[model samples]
Target chain A: MRHRLKDVAERAGVSVKTVSNVVNGYVHVRPDTRARVEEAIAELNYRPNLSARNLRKGRTGVIALAVPELDIPYFAELARHVVTAAGVHGWTVLVDQTGGGPEQERVAASGIGDHMIDGLIFSPLALTADDLTGLDGIPMVLLGERVDHGPADHVAVDNVAAAREVTAHLIGLGRRRIAAIGAQRTPEGASARLRLEGYRAALAAAGIGYDESLVAPASAWHRADGAAAMRQLLASGARPDAVFCFNDTLALGALRALHEARLRVPEDVAVAGFDDIEDGRFSVPTLSTVSPDKEAIARLAVELLAGRLAGERAAPARELSAPYRLELRESTEGPADA
Target chain B: MRHRLKDVAERAGVSVKTVSNVVNGYVHVRPDTRARVEEAIAELNYRPNLSARNLRKGRTGVIALAVPELDIPYFAELARHVVTAAGVHGWTVLVDQTGGGPEQERVAASGIGDHMIDGLIFSPLALTADDLTGLDGIPMVLLGERVDHGPADHVAVDNVAAAREVTAHLIGLGRRRIAAIGAQRTPEGASARLRLEGYRAALAAAGIGYDESLVAPASAWHRADGAAAMRQLLASGARPDAVFCFNDTLALGALRALHEARLRVPEDVAVAGFDDIEDGRFSVPTLSTVSPDKEAIARLAVELLAGRLAGERAAPARELSAPYRLELRESTEGPADA
Candidate 1:
C-alpha cells in the first residue's frame, strides 16, 4: 500500500496541516518541526506524486530559462550553473536560446510563460525597456540587463563597474592609447551601453582623450565579429597601446588578429577582457579578465524563484551585484619599462 | 469570439479529423491538407489553449536532457545545440547535471519521466547497464554510451574509432614515446574503457611499446585533474615525446603544467586533445585536437525523440559515427627540422 500524508503526519507526531506546510516549503514552520517531518518522509520513503499535485494545482513544476546564444562560453557556462542550481530545488529548467533577435526574444518570453512553465529566468539580448509592456502577469527574474518592468526580480553583475575596473587596469599599466572593442549601438539600458559608459568614465578619470575612432564597433558578439572589429581598428592607423574587449570571445578573436598582425601581446599591444572563462587561463599569453561569480548568481536566481513559487512572503525585488575579480595575467602585464 | 475547431475545419474545407490531425502534428495528413489547416490557423489566429488541452490530456511538452556536467565544454556545447534543435519541434529541454554519479543519474532519469515530461535524452555517467533495470516505461534516447534494459533508442559517436584516429595522428608525427592521460577504471561499457581500448589498439598498430606507466589516471574529468595528472607523470621520471589527453580540458591543463616546467610544445613535447573547443584555437600555442560535429548529434537526438513522441516507427537503433577532424595547430606542429 502507498503511504499517505496522514501516515507521515502520524509518524512525525505533527498535524496533517504542519506536514503539508513542511512539504510545501512554508517558511513559517519551525526548523525542528521541519526536520521531524523530513525524517518521517525519509523513513517512509514517501515520494510526493508531483505530477498528480501539479494536475490539481494547475502548475507544471518547471521553469524556463531564455538566454541569447550558448555557443558563447559565458552564456553556456551560465546556463549550466543555472540548471545545476535549479536541480537542488527539484525544479527542472527548460532552456531557450533567442539567437539574439528582438522578435525571437519577444516570442520566447511570451511563449514560455503560457502554461508551459511556472516561471521564467530570462537573460535577454535584444528586448529593451520598451518591450516590457507585454511581459506583465508572469513570474520572471531578469538577468544581464535591467528591464523597466515594474516589479520583477533581477540578478546581474555590475557591468559598468566591471568594465571600468578593467579599463583602469589597462590605464594603470601606462597604456594611454587604449582602444575598446564591442562598441555596438544597442537599445538604451542594455549591458553594452552600460559597459561603454564605464569605459568612458575610466578614460575621463585617467585624463586621456576618449577618441570615438578608437571604439571599434561589432555587429554581433561573436569571435569573428571581434576579429573583424580589431582588424578595422588596426587598418584605421590608430595604433593603440592596449585593447579592452567586451567579453572573452571577442578578446580571444582579437588576440588571434594581433598574432596574425605580428604584434606580440602586452609587449606591443596589451589586451584585457571580461568574463574570466576557463579558456582564458589557457589561451596563448593567458588573458587578463574580470571574473564574475556566475555560480553564485545562478544559486540566488534559483532560490528567489523557488521562494516565489511557494507563495512565500512577497520578497522585495533583489538586484545582486556580485564581486568581479581582476586577474592580472600575461595579456595586460605590459613591458618591463612601463 | 474564439473560433472553434469545427469552425476552423469548415473554413479550411477539411474534415474535423484532418484539422485535429494537423493541430496535433499527426503524420498521416497530406501536405496539402496540412497547408490548408495551417493557413486557416494563421488566418483565424487560432492559438491552441495549451492549458485546456493539457487539462484534457496529461502531457507536458517538455523533455529532460541528463548530462554528466556542463563544465565540460563538450557537454555544454552539446546541450546548447540540443536545446536549439528541440525548440524547432515546439518542445523545451529540461537540463539536469548528474555529476557522473550513479545515484544522481538514476534520480534524474526517474524524476524527469515521473514529472510527466513527454520524453528524455539521457547521457548517463556512472550508472552501468545493470542499474538501468525497471526503467523501461519512458521514451528515451541514450547518448554518449549504450545501456541495455530498455527499448529506448541510442545515439552516440563511435568513441573507439575517434580515439584511435587521434592516437594515430600522434603516431604519424613520428612521436614514439606518446603518453596517454585521463585513464579511468570503470565498467567495461563506459566511455573511458572504450577510449582506453582504442588508445591501446592505436599503439599496437603503430608497433610502439605500450607502457602502462605512461597512462596517468584522473579521478575526475576537469582541467585541475589534468594538471595534477601531468605533474605526477613528469615527476615519475618518464619523459614522453607526445601527450594525448582524453579531452580538451585535460589537454589545456597539461599545457599549463608544461609551460610552468619551461617545456616547449611540439618541438620538445607534442600535445593533442579531443573535443576541439572554441578556446583551443586561442591557446598561446593553439592546441591540436579532434573535433566532432556536435550539432549533428543534437539534431539527430531531437529528431529521434520527436519521432518516438509522435508514435512514428521505432527506427533501427542507430550508432552515428560522426566524422572527426584532426585540427593540426601550433601545439603539435614543430619547427620544420624539429
Candidate 2:
C-alpha cells in the first residue's frame, strides 16, 4: 500500500518535475501548484522521509548558518528571522557560533559541510578571502561580505553607503568634530575599514579634516567594547561634538558611558548609530540610527538558498544591498518639546 | 583508507558504543573521554557524513520546534537560544510557526511524527488534552504547559508563582487598585488563567477586592491586541492605580497607550510586565518585569530531547518550572532621582 511519487503526480494532474519541485520546497513553483501537489500527497498518504530520501538523493534537507554569536541581540534577531524564512522552504537550519574567531569560522564551515547540510549561510566575522578558498563545492550565501571565493551568492547591506549617510546626518546637525567607534581592522572584509572610509567621505564633504585621534578601536562589536572605546576617547581630552557608533550594541554602551560621565545627549554631544535594532527604539531616549530592512534581507537569503537547492544553476551571484533609512529620534534631535 | 567506527574506537582506546555515543553527541560521556575521541577523530581525519549515517540508522539529524510566532521578542529569543543549544548536539532545527492555533498545533504534532523530524520541542499555544490522541510514539519535549494527555518531559517558567510575586510587588508599592491583562481562556492549558489565579492570590493576601471590571482580555498575546484592550479598559472609566501584564510585549503596548492618554508611568498608573526581554531593559523608563532564565530553559529543553532521542526512559511526564525573578525598574517604580 506504499504510494509513489508518480502516483501523487498523476493524482495532482501536474508534471512529475513540478511535483518533485513542490516536495523539495522549490520556490519557483506557484502556490496553487504546491497546494495541489500537497493535497495529492496527503490523499495518497505519501511521505518523503528525509532520512530515506537522503540515501538516493544525497540531500539531507538541512542548511547550516554560521554567525558570530546568538548571545548578541543583533545576531539573535537575525537568526530568528532567517530560521523563519528557511521554514517557508521546508529546510532545517543548523546554527553554529563562530565566536568571531578565524579558526572557529573555518571549523564551522568544514564541520557543517562535512555533516552533509545541503548549503551554508555564513556570516563569518574572521574568515577572509584566502580562507574561503577551502569552501569550494559548497553552496553558500555569504552575509556581511562581498567576497566571491567560491560559486556563492552574497547578500549584505552596503556598509560604506549606510555609514556615509549616518555620518552625513550627524554633520547636517552642525556637529563639526565627530568620532567614529568600531574595529580598526578585521579579517572578514574589514567592516571597520569601510565604515571609517564612509566617515572620512562625510567629513571631507563637510570641509573638515579627519582627526586620527577621533577613530576609536574596538576588539569586537559589543556594548562593553563600545563603552570602553568611548571611555578611551573621552579620557584623551578630545571632546568631539558628536559620536557615530558602528552598531546599536556599541551605541547603547556608548550611551551608558556618556550617561555615567554626566554628558547630555544631543545637547552637549550628538550621538548616532547604525543598525536600528528593536532596543534602539525603546532606549531611554530613542536612538537615531540607520535602519536596515532585516526582514527583506532574510527573505532574499532564504529564497536564494532555496533556488540553489532546487538545481537552479550558476547564475551570477547576487549582492543585495539592503536600503537604510535614517530615523530621527530623541537622542540626536533632543527630547520633544511638550 | 576510510576510517571506520571501530578504527576510531581502537585509536581512542574506548568501546565501540562509547565512540558511537561521542559521535552522536550523547551528553553522558565524560569530558576527557569525549576530548580524547575528538582528538582521535582529528588525527584520523575521520569524516562521518551524517546523511550517510542517517540512512543506516533511520534517523534524520533534525528536530522540529513548534512555537506560536517569532515576531514576539520572547519567542524569537527563545528560538535563537534553542537553535544554538541544539547545534551543540549537531542537530538541525525545523521551526514551525503555529500562530497559536489549535489546528496548526495538531498539524505540527502530526508533521513531527510523520518522520519529517527525528524529534520535537513544542511550545503549544493551542490544542488541549482532547486533541492529543494521535501524538503517541513521538519524542517530544513540551514547553509552556504540562499536558497530561501524553508522556513527555516539560520545561517552563513558574507562571503561577511569577504572577503572584509580580502582583505582590505592585501591591507592596502601596498601589491599591490593581488590574491584570491577559487571555481569559485558551485551549493551550490556560497559561493566562494560571497567571490570573496567582494575581487573585496576591490580592486576597493584601485584602483588596478582585475587581472583575479591571481585567482586560486580549485575543492573542501581541502588542496591538494589548493596545486595543488597554484603550477599551480606559474608555470604560475603570481606572486602576497599577496594571500587571502577562508579558513584556503587552506591557509595551500598555505603556504606549498610557502615554497617549497623558498618564505618566509610576506617577498616575504603575505598570509591571513578565519576561525580561532586551527591549524591556531599554524601554523608556525601563520595564519592571518577571525575568526567567531563558538560556537555562533552552539548555534543559535540548538536553531533555537529546535524552529521549537516546532511548533513555529516565523520567515520565515530568514538569520542571524554573524560578522567575522580579526586576524592579522605573515603569513600576519612579525614575531614579534625577
Candidate 3:
C-alpha cells in the first residue's frame, strides 16, 4: 500500500529525479512527463514524503491544526485554545481549514501539502476508516466524532450523554412535544446520529412516543439551515413546545425566527442548544446549552500528538474524553406552571 | 541595519556554524553557547535566513497569514477568504495568530519560525514602523490600517470614509445625540483613530458640536468591552439617541445591553456598526453596518504577495483599496417622522 518514489518512477517510465522534480514544483520537467508522473501518483495514491524530509533533518517545532472551517465560531474558539496550548510547548501552530468536504479532509488527513509541520491535529468531517488506511508517515491526533478504531488518538466530548442530558432537561419542564433540529440524512453524520440517538433515548425514558414529524433534517449546521429547518417544522404545524438544537448557532437562528414570528422565548417555547459558543452567552435571551471543556480537548490533543512525534509509534492509540457541563440560561428556564 | 549570521557569530564570540546550529534549533549546542547566541541574536535583532533557505532551493507553495486573533469573527472570515484565494494560486496558507502584542507581531513580521512559507500576509495590531524597519528577506503584504509608507503592499477598505458614512446615516435618521463606541486611547489604535476622525468629521459637517462625553473608549473590541462601554455610557447618564460602534461585535454587545435595559432598538437608540459579519445579519432587528469587500481584499492581498514572491521585490510597494457599501437594516431605520 505504501508506494515509494521509485515505484512512481517505474510506473511513469521516468527517472526518480524527474518525478521528484515534478513533486517539488520544479519547472524544468516536460509537460507530458509531468502529466504521466501525476497520473501515476494519483493511481498509486502516492503521498510525497516532503513532510518527513524536513522532520528527518531537524525539528521544525511547528504543528498543524486542521479543522472543518474557521468561520464556524466553535472551531474558531477551539483554534484559539489550541494555539494557546501549543504555545506552551514552544511549537507554532499553522491552522488549516479542510472545508468539511471529503476531498479537502482527505488532503488534510494525508498531509499532502503541509511539508513543514512536525505533526497534525486533524478534525475530520467526511473522512472514513477506509480513507485512513495507509496514513504512512504522519503523526496525527484526531478530534471530534470518532470514525474508527486503532488509527489515531482522539479527544472529544461525550456527545451522546450531553445530548441526552439536554433532552432530559427539556422533558423535565413538562414539555411533551419537543423538536430536534440538525438531523443529518447521511452516513457521514456521525455526530448528528449520536445526538439523535440520545434524543430518542431521552424521549423513550420519559414514556413519550417519538414523533417522526418533530425531527427536522439539516444539510449543514449553519444559521441559515437552522432557520429554514425551524420554519419548515413550524409550517408543518408540529407546534412543539420545546426545541433542542444540535448546536448554539442553530439555536440562535431559531431565536431569530421566533422573534420574527412575535413569539416570546421560554413563555411559549423553551429552546436549548449544544456547544455553548460565546455568541450564545450574549444572545438576547441568553441561550442554554452544553459547554464542552475546549481547553482540555486542545491540551490533551497536543499532548497526544507530542507523544506520537517523540517516537511513540509502538504505544497504543489513546481515546481521551473531555469534560462538559450543561449551562442552564434564560432561554431554557420556563415558567414552573408551563 | 540588517544583521547576518556572521555578525551574530562575531558578537557571540562563536563560529558561524555554531550560530547556525543554535538558530536551527539543534539540541547538540551547549547551554552556554546557546544562551550567548540567543543574547547576541536579541541584541543585534538578527533574523535568521531560514525562510529564504527553503525559497532558494524550491518554492514551498505555502504562505502564512498572521492575524491578531481568530476568535474575532471578522478575522476568521477574512482568513477563510484568504485560504480560498491562496488555493487558487496552488499555495497553502498557514494561519498564525499574533495575539495583537508587540512581541508576537514582531516575531510574525520577522518570519522567524515560519521557515517553510515563501510569503506572509500580516495584519498587525500593535507593530509600528520602527518594528518593521529591518524586515530583510521575507515577502510580506500588510493588511488593515497603514503602519508605514513604502514598506509593503497594503490592502484595506477606506476606514475613515466608511466610518463617516455610517455616522452620517445615523445623523440622517434625525439622531442629534450620537455616541461613538470603540475609541482607543493608545498610539497603536490607528484604525480606531481613523474611525473617530470620520465620526468627528460627520458631526462637524452636520453643524453638531462633538461631545466628548459621547465618545466611549473600549480597551479591546470584544463583545464584553462593548457591553461594558455601553453600560458606562448609560451609567454616566449620557442618554444618546444613537450609537455607532466601530465593529459589528461591539454593536452586537451594545444591543445586548440595550435589550437588558428594555430599550427598543431604533425607537430609543438607533444603532450602527462596521463590518457586516454573519452574526449581525441574524441578530434581532438585524444590524446596519458597513460591508467592506472582503473577497476583493483577500484576492488583492494574495495577488500582491504572490507578485512579490515571484521576484518583483524592486517594484514600488502599492496600496490597493477595496470597495465598501452601507447595509441599512432595521436597527438603523428609525421612525421617519421622529
Best by TM-score: 3
* DockQ of all candidate complexes: 0.34, 0.16, 0.49
Q: What's the true lDDT of residue A316 in model 3?
A: 73
TM-scores of chain B alone in all candidate structures, in the order given: 0.81, 0.84, 0.81
Q: TM-scores of the models, in the given order?
A: 0.81, 0.76, 0.82
lDDT, candidate 2, at A95: 62
Minimal lDDT window, size 10, model 3 chain A: A48-57
Identify the superior model by TM-score, candidate 1 or candidate 3.
3
Candidates 1 and 2 compared: the better one by TM-score is: 1
Top-lDDT candidate index: 3
Tell me the tens digit of each residue's lDDT in model 2 across B206-226: 999999998998867666666
What's the CA error at residue A216 for candidate 2, in Å? 3.9
* Superior candidate under lDDT, 2 versus 3: 3
Residue pairs in candidate 3 whose N, alpha carbon or C atoms collide under 3 angstroms: none
What's chain A's TM-score in each predicted model? 0.82, 0.83, 0.81
Q: What is candidate 3's lDDT per residue for A1-338, written digit by digit as tens?
A: 67898999999999999887666445466878977887787687675544365466566767889888888899999998897666534567878887777766665676645456678898888776667766663788889884746488888888989999999999998988999999997877888998999999999999999999999998788888888888888889999899999998888888887877778888788899998899987887889998999988997787678667656767777888999999998888843234
- In the range A197-219, model 2's lDDT, one tens digit per residue, is 88899899889998989889887
